[model samples]
Target: MRNLRQKQASLVHRPIAWHVTHWSHDVYSQGAYSTLLPGGSPAHRAALGDCLDGRLVIAGEACNPKAPAMVHGAWDDGIRAANLAVRAGARRVIVIGAGCAGLGAARHLSAQGIDCVVLEARERIGGRTHSLQLGPVTVDVGAAWLQQFGDNAVAREAERLGVRLVGTDFSQPLAAASDGPVDGIEAAWEALRRGIDRRLPLTEGVARYLAGLAPAEARATRYAIEGNLIIEACLPLAELSVDSLDEEGVGNDDHFLPGGYRQVIDHLAAGLDIRLGQPVARIDWQGSDVRVNDALGDFCICTVPLGVLKTLQFVPELPQPQRDALAHLGMGRLEKVVLQFDRRWWPRSPTGYLRWYDTPASWVEWLDLTDAVGTPTVAGLIAADAVERQFSGRSDEEIALAARDALQAWACAVEAVR
Candidate 1:
């Protein structure tokens, strides 16, 4: 990794002094899930089981079979685990992390008149949901959008927090297939939608059938299906399980939060007693009680991210079944690069660019930010795999140059349409 960083630094044209240093250089490590099950290969489970003792209940988006790595799913899991712990007669329950799940757990407990403590690993709350000051406005560097329209918990939270929903217009002129002129972009979109629609039912049916099988059988089938879907959807289908889709129903009513999605976390964390910048080093749950040790001291949570649990060292290892389940789970990598332009350089459009490159580094989507804010900022080249790799060591200049080149190509394609 150090060699990679040095190589990245050497590749850039500008002086090393001009390059911005990433404090947390692990781009894949987005701290997105504080209380989610860690999904990976069998090896991931072996590492994860090292942290679990029987009493330390694991709950988070990752832990959820349906919504393994989404913010809302994690939140829901935390709440359910907290409720379970309370019902199990736990007197004082602590939330191990302060992401959406942790906050959700704490909020539910508080609502139920149960006192809980939230321990966060960062200085501020919200694990992966965060915003940054960009000149005059705040830009969301973490979670920027909500999926599934108004039905999802994040969307509902956005509404409750009074965050305005704005539509993304990707109607910009761009290069299209040999089908026709620039106007054919609409046709391309329609075709893509139709394609997705046709395959979606098949995928869903397969998922449902696989969901009922024995643990081993289900894991094998679901893993294959999910791997394919990740490539097709550019998202982990496990995070958008059949349950979530059924709950939302079918719709073209997706929405984005104006103040950034992080505001939802802020609203959720209000008035809650949270401890930040405390990373749990160990968890002891062999005894009747559960104990979590960070740099500060020992605390307790009804549940923790299964991934985190799997990594932490436990005095006594977890049982084989739970360990096996953890091993079967997997984590998909999704990365985003938000570029704030000095001016709105890209053409206007109702639909964003859905590029199809012959190479692995091809960006899947390019979102326009003109409607979201008056500024010229544009979030472009949102690629899952490549971005993760680039984040490892690429300098800001290298990223900027690459984005500029892509934008120039897109701009030319749009001009050809005009």
Candidate 2:
């Protein structure tokens, strides 16, 4: 058997990076689950959460047209459902799926002196807001950060719960796989911004749109484009929508709760009845009466995921248009890979986000978790279509190996700059 020293020596000399490191992957089937595929357009939103015969009301991020796939969107939908329930004279509310949206609805209804029963298919609440143990430290597996402070429900709840938050550094730190760190990448980024400013109605995607610009051939420009368009948006350049870019008004004040996002889940779960391990099979509703198994109520609010709801049985069947909307609106695929290292191998910069321009895979943007989690850890968040093609069916080991190899290349590239 090779000793640790021998193993370390072999790894160093294997044309990889410096010292060998051991890492573990914690993968979830619906990890960072978001509906990013087709469906859920404006036409679909009309029936997404509409009350059917004043007996069934749908809720969740899927119902939110303004901010789908966001925790805040789900939270807001819960509030809307609570109001709808009160207006409909619901004696007791049945909230399906104890996710952020469901819990939010239950919590608000409870506060309003209304009664609600929340049924969760999974054993725990906080649907996508899952936090898991990674080696020695704990990290969020889903819904990690509060995007902004301005009127953000997540941030407000965090403050109320007294959950301390650490602001994530969004400063750009650019590096290329073949050329290492590009020292003057910001200048190129500013030039690209100038070009973007000049192009008013950008119909095409960022990658092609930038390519049409004069100086897009510069290596630094591509780095900037990858970091800004691809990595930041979590989508490929071609798929990123330039039209909705201006619609985002939330200033860059994103933060992560070090105490774990589960704290938020616990806070929202207080004083609410949540039945765990109870998978809802079907919804039978008519004329202000809803039933799921023996759990009967005057009205039902479905906070279940679109993906999960699509598979469930609905009695009397929903309208064809509603079915079509549910069929078309897709769940966007967003996955995260977290690796805990023995020590910090990458450069210690104030930059929070690092992007590798030359990497073809989705592990392009890496979030350094050393400062936040107090571990020599890094988490890679991939949101491009390539994620589905590359990582969908692969096991945790396969994905981790891919991540390790990518990190190996990235470390070598960053090390060369030093």
Best by lDDT: 2
Please give the range of 10 consecutive residues that has the lowest summed lDDT in model 2: 15-24
The digit string of per-residue lDDT tens for model 2 on 1-418 reads 1342243334421211111111112121232333333212444654677877777888887787666657788898888888898888888999988888898889888888887899888787888778877766678877777875565797898898788888876655545454444555667666666566324333243455566756534666666655554444444544434432322311267788776788888877987999998887789885457888779899889887776777678887987767876764544445677877777776665765666655455566677878887878777766556476557577766776666656666666665556
Q: What shift in Å separates residue 120 of candidate 2 from its native position after superposition?
A: 0.4
TM-score attained by model 1:
0.69
Which predicted model would earn the best TM-score? Answer: 2
Off by over 4 Å in 2: 1-43, 174-211, 214-251, 388-395
